[model samples]
Target: MVNRYLPFFQGVVLNQATPTHHPIPGNGNVAVNFDDEPPLLEELDIDTGLIWRKAVSILHPLRSVDPSLHAEADLSGPALILLSLAFFQLLAGKLHFGIVLGWATAASVFLYFISSMLLSPGRGGRGDLSLYRCASLLGYSIMSMTIFSAVSLFLPRGGGLIFAVGMGFVLWSTRVCSRLLVACSGHGDGHRGIVAYPCFLVFMLFSLLVIF
Candidate 1:
């Protein structure tokens, strides 16, 4: 089952990168093999790199009172605390399913970021996964907010609720499918390595079924 919203997700990822990286195709609907490293330049991708830089810029001063101390150190506890507070702020006004779904989505995003942290090969004292994890969570938060905001603008009241429920199911289904694809490949290569793509495609189909 092909993703009904594949184009949409691609659009989101692409909005952050350059036109040269326009067609950011995945293995159909399957989870990408973690072992198969991306190209050196596109590894972090332009979108992710800009985001990383901006976050570091904002984080540096807050993390250290000492002007001599670098921004890298501030990304730890101080960063996490700021992140948690931001989540609280976003949840402050509207504290219902929106909050629940927001946090759940964030938790799953953290899982992805943690996986990357373990997998990525960064150098120096700046290899703090926490910052990346926060970024991942923030990404999800933005996506969710944009989605619901759009829903409120275009969708009817009752229709919006139903659509929101469907969206939630689809999101959960995708996460499950991603996990299953990862499990099936068994962390190997050769013919078995390419299996993740097909598995992900199958999961994508399953997601459509769950969504519709």
Candidate 2:
């Protein structure tokens, strides 16, 4: 009896040993090895050069901004810039990361309404702005404030130099943001003050966060 049942036991063992998973190539479903896939940086195809170029554009606040910088609306650089801003704030003895990020979101939304909602047309229009683009532009503009935050870390508290530097950085940030908005809006320089004013207020608050 034992010998007669051996074949049946062997068949059951063989079935259990076989793998159940198979590459089903149907209806957009395909087998993939997660370990074999590329890293997130490669998968997302992040262009470091583009990020660098945007930073370069932000550095020259007095110069005109390239409209192409807003074309793709990449957010990686902006995210990094904001994180840096928060970190700098953190280093300055303020745990305002949540507040910093929350305010950044609010600022982005505020600018989106000002820049895109007011300027964007119902249909195809020249130099239209999107919310993502607005956010990206605003993110890059904060670079100047981040610089102030870093510098403020080193300076003695209760000094007027921090105030002066913060004000200068706020203006620098406003100039860059306003220029980018105008360049992307196709409205020229006429509406820069409208755009810059809010930016000034936003960065001013950020400066205070750094100073205090």
Candidate 3:
């Protein structure tokens, strides 16, 4: 009697010991590892939130003025911030979204190209930095102005205070961009000042439009 049940128990034990492998869809004969832990979905969310918060912090005048932060800047995070701000401006109906986005993107690309030309190769034979990096520096540096643009939409007419605040942000963004250029381009203060001038003009133009 025990012998008959012994066979069934052995079969069950064997099945349990042998891990089942599931073939991944569309990848023929490729089996997923049952022992491997699945990637955490929450990580992506946390990373995105962190990037957004950094973007917002960069908009602060005091924070953007920090040279250390400029060195660590990357394109993806700031680009997301700019795009989100543009979307909000569009929803506010204060300006044409297409024009705003088109100009902002164009300015970022144009400045990146122009600045790259003016920059010396990175220090210690590191070679020239990528356009994406330059664009990130410029894009994130100008984020202060982007915030001002979004905020101006909600301010009442004849608000001199709003205009003053926008100007301050514009100046701060220019300073940030200039400092970043000094860091990345390995250029002296004078050259960096020259490089940052166009950034100032661009922000000034945009801020004026938003303020008026």
Residue 66 local lDDT, model 2:
79
List lDDT for all candidates, in order: 0.37, 0.81, 0.67
For model 2, state the Cα shift of residue 74 in Å. 1.7
Model 2, runs deviating above 4 Å: 1-39, 117-127
The digit string of per-residue lDDT tens for model 2 on 1-212 reads 33665898978887899776556777465665667878888789788888998888778757877767666878899889999998988887788888888988899889888776545554223546777878888999999988888888888888888788788999898888888877777776777777788888888888888888
Best by lDDT: 2
Against the hidden true structure, what lDDT does model 1 obtain? 0.37
Per-residue C-alpha lDDT of model 3 across residues 12-53, encoded as one tens digit per residue: 877899858878899998988856764574534335554565
Q: Judged by TM-score relative to the true structure, which candidate is superior, 1 or 2?
A: 2
Model 1 Cα lDDT, one tens digit per residue, 1-212:
44666988877766778543233377454554556887765653334444444344333222311211222222233233334434543443333344434543454454445434432334111333344443333333232233333334344445446456545534433343233223322321232233334333432332232223
Alpha-carbon shift of residue 203 in model 3 (angstroms) = 0.9
Q: Could you tally the backbone clashes for each prediction? A: 5, 0, 0
- Where in model 3 is the C-alpha error above 4 Å? 1-21, 24-30, 33-60, 68-73, 121-129
Q: Model 2, residue 111: displacement in angstroms?
A: 1.0
Cα error of candidate 1 at position 15, Å? 55
Lowest lDDT 10-mer window, candidate 1?
62-71
The deviation in Å at residue 76 for candidate 1 is 14
